[model samples]
Target chain A: MPSAAGPLKTTALTRLFRDMGARMVDFAGWELPVQFSSVLEEHQAVRTAAGLFDVSHMGEVEVRGRAALEVVQKLTSNDVSRLGPGQAQYTALTTDKGTFVDDIIVYRRDEDDFLAPIRSFHFIETAVGGTKCIVARTGYTGEDGFEIYAPPGDALDLFSALVREGSPHGLLPCGLGARDTLRLEARLLLYGNDLDETTTVLEAGLDSIVKLGKGPFIGSEALTREKERGPLRRLMGFEMIDAGIPRHGYPIRVEGAETGAVTSGTFGPTVKKSIGLAYFPSRAAGVGTRFSVGIRGRDAQAVIVPTPFYRRAH
Target chain B: MSKGNGIYPEDLKYTKEHEWLAVNGGVGTVGITHYAQSELGDIVYVELPAAGSPVVAGEEFGTVESVKAVSEIFAPVSGEVLEVNTALATSPETINKDPYGDGWLLKLKLADSKELDALMTAAEYRKYIEEEAN
Candidate 1:
């Protein structure tokens, strides 16, 4: 019961947790729920059927005006030029030097209102406050989703409304653990895990988000150059032939030599095998390239494959 | 000994690292105790040492990951790995259901018979764990 009273520093969920029996833990400084039922049960629920994530902890922002699409197109990676009303596209808001601000999703909910899913709740406030750009290019979840950037007083209520609506369409209050697994299964990079301040999206295998032919944005020039020159290192996925699970920074050794590092690894329930993604030298990133995972100083056999180790059952 | 978890066995010898060993004669078996698996949670994948491989004393051997965090499994007593419960590889949850039986991680030929005396009996181990809990 430490005095948890702050605006930018304190989590918005402090009020919600007091009532919901949520076991809160410090996640990147935000006190968020780790689990409601259990981590395993929640993870399985999402994989088997549905999950409603309390992404209220995440940020949301909207861009409004006639030049909304132009601002979005210039700032983000997706081709938002032909975006019509109510349509959304997954993209990334990158830095001017071809680095990542955050991987995001764009929602064209209506004619004038454009929604963005930025990284965290504070990002929207910062974006609106720091950069006086007329429009908001904030929240990003990489889904055909809309994150509402409104007053925090009513944000939790809006989240509940979405859960009430999305529940019927298959949504459960998913915690952070399942969120990590889901994004990793999709081979999407997390901020501190895969894409840091130095880790380029190019090395993270996020080229699809970039439109090299598109007009000038913040980092468009550097990205266009990198695309033509090709990346020095590239991201690739692989399955664990053996039982041992690799983790972030676990050395991906080739022929007893440490060649790369596993950015993400997990037991893929859908694929029924241990799958992980890693960054390796461009020459060694080819699919089917056999490698070894150095676990606790012991070398375990591994192999390079493709993105998305799991295919959700249709 | 587990945070009031009554699921531990007294006959088996345990390590501070959480591995348990049960040896009757030359044919000794190793596995994580019920308390250990419960603490670890639903194990998604298990890396079992191959049959006939030599495991040293207090050596790191395997790993288990659920959703958010991952933990490692170690060797309790040094011996030659006789056999691994292969079933745990495909369905590691057997550890959750039967850590004492089918969930038994591996079988080993106890390299030193005197090492058997080095482990704690069920009641004593239980007492030791209960003390650690507080």
Candidate 2:
């Protein structure tokens, strides 16, 4: 196998994954397991039983000092004042254009500190190689889970300890394949694939997190204007009515005309259907709005449906 | 033909794409190899071409979608599809559990028997996979 361009970084549990015969793929710049056994198996495990995930590839940024909450509130789209210590909220780091810098989970550690779980698009200065760490109740997978942020040297021990403790609860070390499917089933947007710098928070179907009235933030002006104008396209969920699986970048067509495109698509293991998220014109964005997805060269029938395709009973 | 790793059947003709053809007289039964199903993780959906559809060797006949990805199943030999295993629509995991038996994809009436000569035997296919793996 040809090596990855740069030296592929290994997570704390990389050796354990290799020993378990995990199929590894380079994600971002980190060598991570795509699956250990099967995506369906791991996905079902998370839905029914608990499944451990080594999401150490995700970056951790800490904002601390007396003005920590102010800094975070100014940068993120969500209201930081609402988060109590030990609570975490899904939020987006936005640009001046009201588009996403990255979608992140902000965990309120204390009055002076907050931990943000961000994708590896770029690293913030404070948290890199920092000694301070915190455990937060947050995860991309729509499960009751906690993410632990620690120094690089401490990651492996923490991961190993989690595996050891969680083994009895049926926590198999999950991988990116299961992670992607799980997040998709939960209607969670992935940064690069679903939400990019060009797409505004409202268009990405994340208006609930944009707390526009919470006082001025980086993107407040544009977001307020976009809110008043109404978004042109809205992100929505759809299920395939035809045999084919809808994949990313497949054109979304309405009445034989291209209307939008799929951002994230996969066979949802838990839901037992091929489901996807896509941007559609506002007129066709309602639930049950019928459409077709261009799968390969043929049009497979699809329809806009309610989101979070699968939710736990609790 | 020879079996390797006790998975691939020695009687089957194999393609580099990992499909196997079991020829009997003029008709052939086709399915993916154990290695293919194992590599694909969980098979959640199988889209088979309708019966009577014409297929050409080395061309896509249908698709097998796992939770992780959708993979095209290529025809190993040119033929007309006579039957599709509809049982897969409800239980696609059969491909992972028994890819050679209950997981068989289709039966085809061979258009030209000479096409089988181009396929690899089980032993050759195993060697090909081993070489590719390295």
Candidate 3:
């Protein structure tokens, strides 16, 4: 393997992961476990039962004082005023052009204090193995799960305890690889891949979170204009009809002409197919629209389909 | 075919690209090595040349795509593809579960038997892999 520049940063559970024989890889400058046993196995565990993930690498910021809600509402595209204490809403930190700076979740701890970034259940202030942390009913994976924001010093113990307790229910200590496949199968957008600086919120098909009627905020003008004009392109979900896995950055074609590229793609273990997300002309981004993804030197057959490929029965 | 021992299987000739060939009556059965399968994590797709296609030694023939990356499989020796593992189209993960037995990729009619002399023996391949890992 090629050497990475300088040293890769390690999370609090790095040592424990090494001892457990995890396959480590550099993910966005962090030395994180890509898999413990295998990607497919860990992915299946999450869908069938449960899985624990070390999401300490995800950024966490706490906003306090009297103007917390005002600051959050102005900075994010979602209507923060709608959230009550302990509630969370998936929103985006948008650029002026209605594109994303970063997609985050906002959790209302109180009228004056808030923490962020996913959509789903409320945040629970609890002590796990005597370690005080905020457990939020949120995750990138579409499965029912909680993301715990713990103090750095107490992360390892908290993670280990959760694994021990959850093991009997078939919980596995999943790594980034499984995390990625699971999220993609659920049609969750990854930051750098699906929601980059150039792609607008409306184009990403996340209009539900963009509350224009809530009043002025970052990117509102551009979003309002774009909404009036109608977005020319849209992010679409597709599955390979041929025997090849569509991958990130691979060129996508429509009728032998290069159109766009795959933003996120993988062989979904649970869905049991090669699924991916890519941008397409709005007119062409419809269910049953046939296209081709260029995989290696070949044009693999594919077709647009409804997203959230795997949904929880509940 | 020489009945061999362990994962390496002494009878199989190896390549620097981590592919193995089991020779029997001028025909060679090809598959990736144990080390290769384990390193690949999970094999999701396998692209192979059709029967009667020609392959050149040390040249690209097909590709094995794992969950993480794709690796090109190289020809161990020049030959005509006699049979391909069609079952792998749907069950590629079999390569990770059994790299040497049911995971065999293709059967080829060897163009030159002397090419076997240039390939690594099981013992030499093991030592080569150890040195390469470091």
Candidate 4:
């Protein structure tokens, strides 16, 4: 629990992070490790070998009933009917207006049981002192990984077990800083930074998962209409050509005219350049389109580039 | 080769912003302290001002960017920039690898030599950071 101005809430691995000399920061009301060794080192560790992360702050919701699949199908954009037990699918809970409620990963445990990963709030009841627990192969980073759900009391033990098991593979304990850079290099969309309630799935370039031909679900009608009408704005990737680092909320301009604002921006470790995502008018959102980003009161030259900036060799 | 916590050089002056100034014959070499680089975590970019730029004491002169965030670097003493470390342009990780040596950011020709007296001695800086941690 967090007070008004006190310290943020901690996960089970918080003490372990401190013991390892991690630098902590308040993220989404949780006191999480931003880095232990260094962001660059941890990021390279994940790319070349493997890095472990304490993502216990992510929320879990268990839906168990005869209508479990129906409830999930009604709420998410992906085709839930295609998911068999023990499988997981990336999805988004959309509003009636075809905008995001939240992006999530749904794990179908059984015909009547499903687990959805959210931003906050842990579903520890299903993990501890319960009959069944489902571990799913899912991650926000564009690497192969698994997210484990366990009871709050069991979190420490689980984390320790993972550390012990993964030690031989040169697994280092990673933190949020490495996580952000790795995901950004992969061009994954962050919820608050990339998608919001007012931003439609089509506009966010997530049309593959929006199966319109499937039977109706929440926001299906609006999404269908959107499919017919096309999106007004599109999220695009950009790399800085001139010297300057673009930051979130920086103005994106075209020929001295303000066009859009950067949604997320950072110096990508893998890419070895400053990269970012921003909304551009559909007409100007083509690959190689030149523009400028406002960085430190100066217009830095930039150009739209293809996404998934650094894809791992599969 | 230097000693003292294996990071902070005992003879250098430090700023509250975590910058260090090694003054030699009224010309000071400026760089971020070991604490700054450790806190920043794998610096990916260092934005430096051009040579001959006038830098005022306690004012932001440049920025140091890590993967997670960007931080402004403040000048420890009033001076004119003599040279900027161009090596950092292609290899910013030098700040993390050798913050005190190869990572030195800039060389400044001091405008007021006495300004160096206002900066904290290494012992005072160590104490100051310890207090801040508490």
Candidate 5:
């Protein structure tokens, strides 16, 4: 259901959000818009032209004090020195033995603010779990953009301002449904969908984020060990040919033997077919390699393709 | 996105899968229905059948993927993929705005004119939506 402006006086942001036919959902105790128009309309708008989303519900906290940058870089896997102002990067908040604490987009704005997709404690989620330093946002969307970090109260206002300014161009208000399809098409891993506490980064096919030879990071020892020892399982993207769409936890069989399970699957708008991401043995992760996705009782033909299911025209 | 002023034309016969066929000669010109496009919302991508590809009745000819969902464009009747709306690659929303006209997904030559009677009339299709809803 959707909420009309109540308690708080009506404002432009409130009215605009309501006018878009937004399905309001309570996320982390704050009111957030889930979908507007339809999940399909918003999702396609973002992929084709531009879709603006208000992520004001996301909270931001600071960890700056000079040691801020180092504390963060050591705590995260990526080299954060490159982030200056508008630039941002993707890094993980990890545990003592290479377990994932959270996946954070580290933004080095006026100060460092790491936006955790799933609402959680900003610093304690990363640092207290065995972080060497602080973190912030870098690259998201694979498009030209950077995330600005501020407290929820401030973020709500700023996001409203951004929509006003960005909408004059081609930016139309988008919702969470668009966000999910957008990232999945890019092969970007949403923590819960593709990564979890027990799932290590190496198994997620995130060597791009892990620097095995870089200076000491929190999970360096175990991560580097996994790198040297070789990863046991790896992530792969596949397209369904004969089988029904493989959803979360759908099993994968390699020549009648269980190989891995699907992490996520859905109709890929850009690919025009049902595509999904899953983890399988490293040897079976090659592109074009065939596998079977067990749906209910019958199995479907699924072949490994590249990580991202689609590539948009630049 | 604007399908001009007219989208659902009166002269065309519609298939349950949302395709409309207008027969003039030995060939039937096919397109998506206005109702079909509206149901699809914003179309981000489309797959066109190759020219002259033989199609069968009740079989999938191609697919149309909106921002939210995807569905196969089933052959309204047995035919061949005569021609496709090439403009769809640049403006997929035409399917949403003028599915029966500019957004016509593809055209085909009827394998049998008898198949035409098997389709629903405009009034029948409208009543069909009502029945499906109830």
Candidate 6:
């Protein structure tokens, strides 16, 4: 039987990606390239040079009305009042328990207009190679790059144009595989992997975005209470001290017993080590804390470490 | 990748699982096919049974880990493990760069020379992969 949701959705650049011999995979119900050349190579390119990525699967929303700010402010955890015209910030739509509905970027285009506030967006609306797109100085990867929000029809053209221009400068077309490794190295949390509605913002260590003094909003009550009580579990970073790649859902052990679960883990190509993120008891989540990650049913030694494992030189 | 030179040597016998065996006397050297390595992308780790271990034909003997996934390595024919490619422990990318030569995973003292007849010829394996792709 066919899936009730139907077949996977394809981005405008899907055909082009296939034509370029990219290896495709299913990601969040969308057909996207996992890699073109290789994950390691593409990751290095983005770190040292540049890489183009098709993130059209990310949803977009726009709001323009007198009550837009009132609604957005009430819905998001970040201080919407801080955003002036043509500004953006990473924020989250909170559940009633102060957990994430989704982590989003709020782009305030004007006094009562916000454009492209979803998973990612920056602060600019521009054109590239005659194709109009909302070019935001934002990316999931830690590198200084832009996420171009182009119309479905213009996506292929804009991608091609960027590739043509960037080819001489050594820009490889990256895929979701490279995107994942890059973000993990930067300690950027992925929703399904590192966070969910069951985990609160305080627990996720995103207090910077939660404005308790901004007056009551959807999740303010729970957030305030949680803040007073302190988070029970704290998400932290760790690296493998032994051979084996820590993977998502792997069991984390404090000694010989299960303590927490690995949320997102990978061989960070840039860091040249196996690194991961997991939630542990706040008391034991400090850096230099030793732990074990079970890989293929065998516990491997690991150690808690400071996050954002790779920082780009300014 | 390069699809590995697009050559499957006629001197070897192949399994449907994409492993190849070069039999000389009672010993058979084994490795994954070029098609297998190319499909697997970059190999980052290889886990093999230690020498003196016995492996049964059609059973998993070890594993190969790439950046994105882990694949079990299946034995082509029953044999006693003679040696493993220790270099792959630190430099597994050799499987991606040279799957046939330096990337050879294991050597076995054959348990059943007759089992080799059940595997495919290079030409037959080539046809098998072509069908698998479609």
**Reproduced native contacts, each prediction:** 0.50, 0.75, 0.60, 0.75, 0.20, 0.25
Error of 1 at A124 (Å): 19
At residue A169, candidate 2 shows an lDDT of 84
lDDT of 3 by residue, A56-115 (tens): 888889999889989999999999999888888899999999999999999888433344
Among these predictions, the greatest TM-score belongs to 3
- Please report, as a value between 0 and 1, the fraction of native contacts recovered by candidate 2: 0.75
| Candidate 1 TM-score to native | 0.75
At residue A169, what lDDT does model 5 achieve?
Answer: 63
TM-scores of all predicted structures: 0.75, 0.91, 0.95, 0.90, 0.60, 0.93
List the pairs of residues colliding in candidate 2.
none
Report the poorest 10 consecutive residues by lDDT, candidate 6 chain A. Answer: A111-120
Residues A99-135 of candidate 1: C-alpha lDDT, one tens digit per residue: 8788776766543433464422112222333332222
Q: Name the candidate, 1 or 2, with the larger lDDT value.
A: 2
Docking class of 1: acceptable
Instruction: Judging by DockQ against the true structure, name the best candidate.
Output: 2
lDDT of 2 by residue, B81-112 (tens): 99999999999999889989999999999999
Lowest-sum lDDT 10-residue window in model 4 chain A: A119-128
- For every candidate, how close is chain A to the native chain A in TM-score? 0.76, 0.89, 0.95, 0.89, 0.77, 0.94
DockQ of each: 0.35, 0.54, 0.46, 0.52, 0.13, 0.41
Instruction: Rank candidates by DockQ, best first.
Output: 2, 4, 3, 6, 1, 5
Predicted candidate 4 versus true structure: per-residue lDDT over A60-123, tens digit per residue: 8989988998888889899988876666778889999889998888776644543465222122
Better of 5 and 6 by DockQ: 6
Per-residue lDDT of model 4, residues B62-133, tens digit only:
999887778999999999999999999998999888999999999999999888889999889988777765
Candidate 3 on B76-108: residue-level lDDT in tens?
Answer: 999999999999998999998889988999999
How many backbone overlaps does candidate 4 show?
Answer: 0
Model 2 ranges with Cα > 4 A deviation: A1-4, A111-133, B1-6
Pitting candidate 5 against candidate 6, the one with the higher lDDT is 6
